[model samples]
Target: MPGIYLGAILFSLVGMMLIDLKYSLALRVAPVRTTLTVLISTSFFLAWDLVGIATGVFVKGDSPLFVGVTLAPHLPLEEVFFLLFLSYLAVVMVAVFERRAAARRRHGGGRSATHRAPLEESA
Candidate 1:
């Protein structure tokens, strides 16, 4: 019960990673860039949340859904995973789109660009 919320999030994160692997996404496609992207994005959001909490604009709500763990006064453990999930989502979306575009290019959406006759022959 202590880790219920966090556990669910971790499990889902694993699933997301598996999806990425299956599609050669993020870590598979560009491990370094993908890692940096996720780390930076999560850090930015966490900092933003911290600022809000400091300004009294954000407050932790009582939720049975939460495992009720906190990393700070009002920061829940699940908040971290939620951020992680968001980062993964972005990475996955970008990877999926990129893969689709690549597939299209490799297949035959447009061969004109790659196939060009000699200049003199066309004239």
Candidate 2:
């Protein structure tokens, strides 16, 4: 089970890299920037997770299915992977939403500058 979980984490990381590459090529965005954003966001998420675990909001059980040390009811390593997964998911979801919104705007919902009548017409 630990092996399976580790494999899944590896697969997710690779998948995220591919997705980032596609977005970078299509949008001319920087992969480094996206990676940095993910890193920062993941850091914050890890902090939150740590706090939550400390507060007993949730409990993490022992799993031979993961790597890294487990501190009581929390596994720091698992939390890190969870953050990565969540950040990747969030970025992809946002990109999809933005694309759909842009497409909708392009399909006649967007207002043109000329479409707005002058507030004060010339005499």
Candidate 3:
């Protein structure tokens, strides 16, 4: 009830983090890349949200989960957290696909540099 919105967001964030841990899709693949991806994506969208708020396109909605704090008019404190979750979600999505693709490639085997089977030296 009162905790529904914020609880859902926190749960999803934790779930994604756990998936990242189990697969090592983020830190193992590229820690810097994942960090930058999340940071840059979050910044871009936050800026977009700020613009929307300034332009009156965005408005804070009544929510039991929001702390009722805001950096600006119609911008709730929860929005920042939500944006971070969104960014993490995007990066995790890329990491998942990358993992699957690499697995597929490995299982499918690799071709030689010229796209042919590797030549074996004379036995």
TM-score of 3: 0.77
Sort the candidates on TM-score, descending order: 1, 3, 2
- In candidate 2, clashing pairs total 1
Which pairs of residues have clashing backbones in candidate 1?
none
TM-score of each: 0.78, 0.69, 0.77
| Residue range 3-44, candidate 2, lDDT tens digits | 567678768877876875676532236556667777899989
Error of 1 at 98 (Å): 1.4
Residue 36 of model 3, lDDT score: 90
The 10-residue segment of model 1 with minimum total lDDT is: 111-120
Q: Is candidate 1 or candidate 3 better by TM-score?
A: 1
Candidate 2 displacement at residue 86 in angstroms: 0.8
As for candidate 3, its clashing pairs are none
Which regions of candidate 3 fall more than 4 Å away from where they truly are?
A: 1-4, 109-123
* TM-score for candidate 1, residues paired by index: 0.78
Which residue ranges in model 1 land beyond 4 Å of their true spot?
Answer: 107-123
RMSD of 2: 7.0
Which residue pairs clash within candidate 2? 2-65
The digit string of per-residue lDDT tens for model 1 on 1-123 reads 466777888899999999988878788878899899999999999999999999999899877778877888789989989998999789899888887899888988755664766874576
